[model samples]
Target: MRDLYSFIIWILSYQIITGQDPPREQYNISCHKVRETCMQDPSKSVPRCIENYMRRCSMIRTRTPVEGYYTRDMSDSRPMLETEEGIIVHISSEALQKSRTKEKMNSNLIVSLVNKTFFVTNSSPEVVYGDNVLGVWLGVKEISNLSEPVQLRFINSNQNENVSCVYWHLDQNGNGYWSTEGCSTNVTNNEFVCSCNHISFFAVLINPKIPEEIHIVRLNYISYVGSALSIVFTATVVIMFLCQRKKHSENSIIIHAQLAGSLFLLHVLFLCSVWFSDRSDQVCTTLGLLLHWCLLATFSWTAIEGFHLYLLLVRVFNIYFKRYMLKISLVAWGVPTVTVMICGIIGKYTSVYGKYAIHEEKEKSSNTSICWITTQTVISYITVNGYLGLVMLFNTVMLAVVLVKMHKLRSQDVQIKLNKKRLWKDWVSLLGLCCVLGVPWSLAFFTRVPLNLPVLYMFTVLNSFQGVFLFLWFLTLTCKARKEEFVPSKGTLNVSFQSTEEHITTNVVSNMIQKK
Candidate 1:
């Protein structure tokens, strides 16, 4: 028994000395795996995926052959290099010389071109630039501060906005985040060029996020109150217009009614958006579609307002389009309906509408949920802001035309001399007409940039009360139209808008013809 125990002890000692497990190979994560995980259903959290992959990659032992990159050693000269993924890397002769002096002559230059960025991610906290924007990790082992910037050429990530060069930096949370400390970006139609001083994982960020502020909460509050007031005011105006249809049946009045109706519908639906946002996918989707349609309808009608004004003010003669109201209604209502239908079809394939975060985004939790366009940046841009852009641009030109023509003709009517109070009233009426034509919409352009707090406040307040302003403008026009209906009966030329049911009777035009 003693001999057997001694033999067992010797065997155990020999096993401990000779058979300890070989140190496990450092983590070897495949870029393929990273992409696979990132593309998973419902998408992995960006920070978590980045943290996981980065943690794995940092542990990976650098070897002659690395995953997802072409490793080439620079010894004799500057090399023209391209990756299998069609990423182009350029090393200037001066940069090569700098590399020779800064890094070991045999150090390898690596180009890691992944289809998607493993570092920067689209988390719920912030809006990402674009989906096609890729992440490229450039590395020169133990190298920093070269004589010339190393150039990296990538396929253009986004076309609409400028792309910014950034590197992966660990934030306070110890997760990878994008920072613009050491790189410069040059953009073109076909590609993006990144020039950097030091080597790290690089990518492009477009359209820097609107910085979060406590004032955003205040803006939301203002929007809420203004929208509520607009709802009441616009609803009342729409109802009055419906009741007084025979009294104010002019084309401009009809157009104004449609505008008020659109605003009324918009604010009514908008007020319920938050409560209904969390209901269900189908409910949220339908609400989103309705909101989108209302907005487009508003924009379409605003464009029509500009067109009508141009006809009345600039081309006062030779004015007639067959079935004019029918055609205009088709464009104002039908086009946006068609657009929303197309988007609803597309929304099935992608997340185009759902719960929209309403609180300051950088916060972890938000109390309010708005049923708006949740994703689909391109579609949102085209249908919402881009459409508004075109409408506002057209209206701006119309406003300018009105200003010039009105100024030239301000005192042209010698027969109908106006007192100062009457002239100022005309100016006030014209200004109100311009506002009702969507001048406040331009405030959004200013708020599109980061940190425009004052402009943001202005944008929120003015746009939210757009309907109320339109209602007041209508009231003024109604009072003026009523008082001036009997002016044509008088022999004296009114030299102001003599509105009739079928047309805007600009007697000034006829008087000018008579003078000629």
Candidate 2:
């Protein structure tokens, strides 16, 4: 029992870092059967942990080999060597493959360790300057062991030539993959230098034989872009709000500012949860769903305003501000609140509702490292997006009708004999703002149907810019002090009351005169 416990503990500690059992020869007596033996031990935590790690790791490392055992020194750290001409970064294949185990490791797992040494002169550029910088890379392909071709792309931020730095295929053995031009290339000019700053790259293993080939796999680059845009958009909205504050009505200004601030906060929260924490947590998952709901609600409220104006102007209905004030509040606050709660509950019980691809990444992609929601069932994902699309569709149609009505009214009023046309101007401008901001964001609910980076980026860019239009037309274009010309007939009411009082007084005086 003691021996079993000790073995379980040892495996747990080792798996925590390298994330897998390396070579069977290193353990000698077969650590694969350790779980079976350790299950009989007094405690179950350590053995269970080992089992979980192995299950998760095996799903990811199917094609990629474990490092260290096949390549570089694994003693303490990798070696460092320097040269006057350029930098030398050495990574052995054996060490890499040795550490590749059947355990779930972090994306931050250093797949390859390098001995880097630079000895450039002081006057030389930073890329060539003397500094021993470790170049760490993830997902190094076992090029020598694969049949079809593979690529090892370098970081090319400058958009220079030599874009195809590494490309290779099997010679004949059908047992290996190789890099054609080795690893490093010398650059002549500073303009075309390859560095980690501006460019990011990935490797692709093409044409895997038969049923095991992983296709349609995507990376979490969308999450990266979404998060980045969220930050930038948040900042832009904040600046615009500050600049345009004096031009708006107090109520409209407050609501617009709150909307901007809320969006900024929501995105920031998402950014942190995405890049820093796990999306599987109850809090993070709920918050992520809430952010989306908030975005939908924001546009939904704007559409409501447009529809309300259309009813008042075209249908000739009284714009009783009191009657619809509560409705506006309900649509703005109630809908999103309910949605977020429902999503949270679903995420808690089933894996479908709040599992945003930004945070809840799959343990095993079964192919490429794609970051998407792996629901307990696929139908649930379809259902959620379907519902969102429908809601957005309804709002879009309603607003479109409102805009058309406003245009027609404007054309009709233009021909009529009126002085200022103030009503026409204000109402039309409001409708225009609604169309501009709400249309693009509404389009996003459908565009993200296929779920990809390009679409995601396109949507993000559009949605982010919506804040600008929102501030410009809705919040910054109107003045708070100006009263509308359409106030009820106060002068007519007062005159009628006075006339009735005078008639009563005259009747009383005539009665006295008759009595006299």
Candidate 3:
């Protein structure tokens, strides 16, 4: 009993040291075989196979036995048998060595063959003289897209003295599929004298590999170009706003220019910081969070603009200009600032921002790129886009109300009604400017799916054209400049158009000059 416990412990130790766990049944069967075979040759039994098994098991276990039971003389003397699915076979030293050698050479190969249902067998083990032979049974070669697996039966008829060993090989046609092929060898006892020789059968498999560089390159290129365009357009708008500030009246420049310029510039900086850098850095991660939050601020500002204009024209409510400006500015800037700060703090604590990048399975094109919030982060997304949508809706309604009220006022007044009508036209033009600049963009942004590089670039290009549209419209609206009032000082183009009296005065002057 003590010896049995020692043997089990040794086997376990060997398994641990070698990192090899052969089937537990293999050891159990060998032990059972030893017990049965011992009964047959009780007096001659130092059960050689059992001792050899213990030795192999012990090599992998915690402790090594100082002395072994099986003598070198008895190593080859024991006649052993193993059964594989009703096929009885002789187990010889050569067969054992063959199995060991194959395991040492390639571990995964045998496992792959096993997974493919390849069966290895011994070649005529019963007829040969203490011989070592490796053979296998294989399925027939399969051909065609819709056919069943081929079936083949293998038989081995060797002398009783020989050993049996088998392994399988797979033949691949370079495509993803494979066919089975059996490889085997036969060795004599004399071969065991110098070095124990063995044979094995195996199959080969090809793994699937994806080309990573192509995708990476495309994504990076899109990001770089999109980021560059966004930054450039934003910078240009900001610079134009700053440089042309003194040329415009103080009210027009400060109220419109500063807010618009700041929003545009901030959006540019946000885009560049979020998408331009490699996503592995902490800066990129934080920027991604921060940028989206600032984007919310921009949305809020758009609402502020719409609301302010609506209050001025629609007569739904009256607000002092100072109070309106302060309140709108505070709400627009403060909301995003606070939201972003909270997000940053949460991210610092949890190390996970509420955003991620998504890509398609076969996405190799830059045009297919988008970095957007997922449905899971829809709360934040809705807050930004929904606010813009509501503001736009309100602005549309307000514009309609203003048009109706101005028409009603014109119908009631007879004198200076033309002038009031002109003022109404100016308001309409202002509304047109807002619609052209803001409406299409808001529509695109609200309806678009997950944002990516191409979308970013497209949006930037569209928004960049906003300044041109505004400048052209403003210039066209102020087209009635008179020669007498042509006072161009510094960068300001201050000129007024002539009324009928001014025209008559100009003609009288011209007539006097002609007579002289």
Query: How does model 3 score by TM-score?
Result: 0.42
Off by over 4 Å in 1: 1-26, 30-48, 58-213, 360-364, 411-419, 486-507
Q: What ordering of candidates by TM-score runs from best to worst?
A: 1, 3, 2
Q: Tens-digit lDDT track for model 2 on 1-516?
A: 999977977776665334243333233222233333333432233323233332223222224433221122233354322222232333333423433445622212222221111111111111211122222332322223322222222333343332222222222221112221333333443322222211111121121111112212222344455555656665665665555555533233344455566556555655554453343555555555655565556655554544543443345334456645556667767766776566556666655333333221122332222112334233333434554466556656655655565454345444321525645654655454453335555554443232333554556555555544444444333332122123322212211111111222222333335446
Please tell me which predicted candidate would have the highest TM-score against the true structure: 1
Better of 2 and 3 by lDDT: 3
lDDT of 1 by residue, 234-335 (tens): 988878777777544567767877888888888878877866877988898789889989988988888888888888876677668898898999999999
Clashing pairs in 1: none
Task: Indicate the residue-level lDDT of 371 in model 3.
Answer: 25
Error of 1 at 507 (Å): 5.3
Q: What is the clash count of model 2?
A: 32
Better TM-score candidate (1, 2): 1
**Over 4 Å off in model 2, which ranges?**
1-265, 278-283, 299-303, 321-323, 352-384, 413-432, 435-437, 445-457, 479-516
